[model samples]
Target: MVDLMEHAGANPGRGTYGMAMAASRTVFEARRDCAALLGVKDPRDLFFVSGCTEACNLMLKGLLQPGDRVVVSSMEHNAVTRPLHVLSGRGVRVDFVTADTAGLVDAEAFERAVAEAPTRAIVCQHASNVTGTIQPIGDLADIAHAAGALMLVDGAQGAGHLDVDVAALDVDAYACSGHKALLGPQGIGVLYLRSGLDAMQLVEGGTGASGADEPGQPLDRPERYEAGTPNTPGIAGLGAAARYQSAHGAGIRATERRLTVRLREALSAMDDVVLLGPAPHDESVPVVSFTSPRAEPDRIAFELDRRFGIAVRSGLHCAPWAHRTIGTLDTGALRIGIGHGTTDADIDALLAGLDEVLA
Candidate 1:
């Protein structure tokens, strides 16, 4: 990856036919690797974007027209909510299906939301970023399709951590961040669109050539959505990360799950601590959230970092609706995320830090 960046930096004129062909091959290979990771058959169905936020925006803005009705889950990150909020301002009616205290969105509530209105799409997260709850996306997609609404999943927290098969879920659109569970470089994201879905292009610019004078006459498939110069270095890094994850994802996931269970069990044992989301050993990603009755979440996070050399995310985590659903809107929780590299010693250190801080 570094070698490619160095080469591209030295020879800036990668726009030449030969150089362009090389670049195209690299980008397509990256796309193919990402698609394989997501269980997508065709690499062309996936489009690279700046990040998952942009990918979510492209799917939301590209699919829904003005005044279209969309149903979303309450556990969605701001990536889905903020765009829907913006679309709502433009006459799109957005309705939310509330989740239970376990951070699981009720399928019945989603069905009711879809049945109540003329829904165009159902937007949801495959897993809650704040609480690590894995949603029932397959059932939700079934309900959406039965109601004649498209199902869109934000897989930012789910992919690379969980076994994600877009075909099995039957979703129309899936968005994921390369930097999150994928352990890739920042600023790169992937969006997978179901075959035959005509999503209006969100951004338009030079896409090689189409032999048409009109700027609107863009190229087909991946080229149609990808405009301007691509992020070659970031894409290369993402591809490398995808390859790594593909090779050792099972072992990584097992380690993460074990650490998550240990952390959740320790926190739940604390009398003053309020553990959020599912039970200690539920089916979820390796994310644990909790709040202390006597200490502020930010203060706890600060103390942990300063006193114990531990880092954690605090507050709403860009999902106010998730907090609201879990009854933490007034006081956001402290979040500890486990990754592929998180060790048992790291989990022990965090638990010890929490004990000291709370005491």
Candidate 2:
């Protein structure tokens, strides 16, 4: 990725020079490889953007129309909900399938929400960013299919941690970040739109190719949605990250699961500590959120970073709906994320640091 950033310096597309061709080839290959990470058959169906937030915006705003009715989960991040909120004011009817206290959105709730018929789309996160509870994506997809609504999954948290085969999940659209668990440079994202879904082109600008052929943007898979020059370095990095995950994703997930159990068990043992989401031993991503009556979430996170050189997140994690669903709207919670580089020693250090901070 760094090499590409340094060498593939020329702008891609509509160029026949050596560096220009190299840059275009880099992006083309990156798109092909990254699409495979999401199990997309055609590489052209995937588009690159700044990050997951942009991808979410494109997916929501470009897909639905004035009279469309969309069903989303209560645990969705502001990325999904905020766009829907804006669309709602314009004529889109937005309905929520509220999650339980465990931050789990059941397919039954989804079925109830979509039962009214004529639903246009069913949108939800693949996993709760705040709680790490994996949502029943396959089951929800089945329900969405039954209702004849398109299934859209926000794959931000679940992309690198789980086997996010968009084909297997049978989702119409998927958006995910390239950083975080994917071990790529930030500021890049992937949006996979199933072929034949004629979503409105939200961002229209120069697409490098065929700019002179037509007055409007090219009516194609990626060029239609992607505007202007893309983040070549970031896309290159994301492609490398996805390729690495494809090789060792299973083992990486197993390691994270074990670390999750270790962290959750220790947190559960402490008095006054309230763990959120699934039980310590349940199936989930390697994310744990907790709050204690005796300490504020912010203070805990601050102390851990300042005193012990440990890092974690506090507050609602940009997912206020999830916090509300999990009964942590007021106090929020401390989130400890176990990632690819995190190790057994790191978990031990975090637990020991928490004990000292509490003391």
Worst 10 residues of 1 by lDDT: 6-15
Give the CA lDDT, 0 to 100, for residue 50 in model 2.
87
Model 1: per-residue Cα lDDT at residue 99 = 93
* Tens digit of per-residue lDDT, candidate 2, span 1-359: 77876777778885879888888998898898888877999999999988889889889998999999999999999999899999999999998889999899989988988997589999999988899999999999999999889999898998998888999999999999989787778999989999999888778888887655688778877888888888888888888888898888889999999999888888889987899999999889988999988799999999999998899999999999999898999999999999988998898888888888887
lDDT of 1: 0.89
Per-residue lDDT tens digits for candidate 1, residues 103-170, read 99989889988999899999999999999999999999999999999999999999988988899889
Clashes of 2: 0
Model 2 scores what on Cα lDDT? Answer: 0.89
The runs of at least 3 residues in candidate 2 whose Cα sits more than 4 Å from the true structure, single-residue gaps closed, are none
Looking at model 2, residue 83 earns an lDDT score of 91
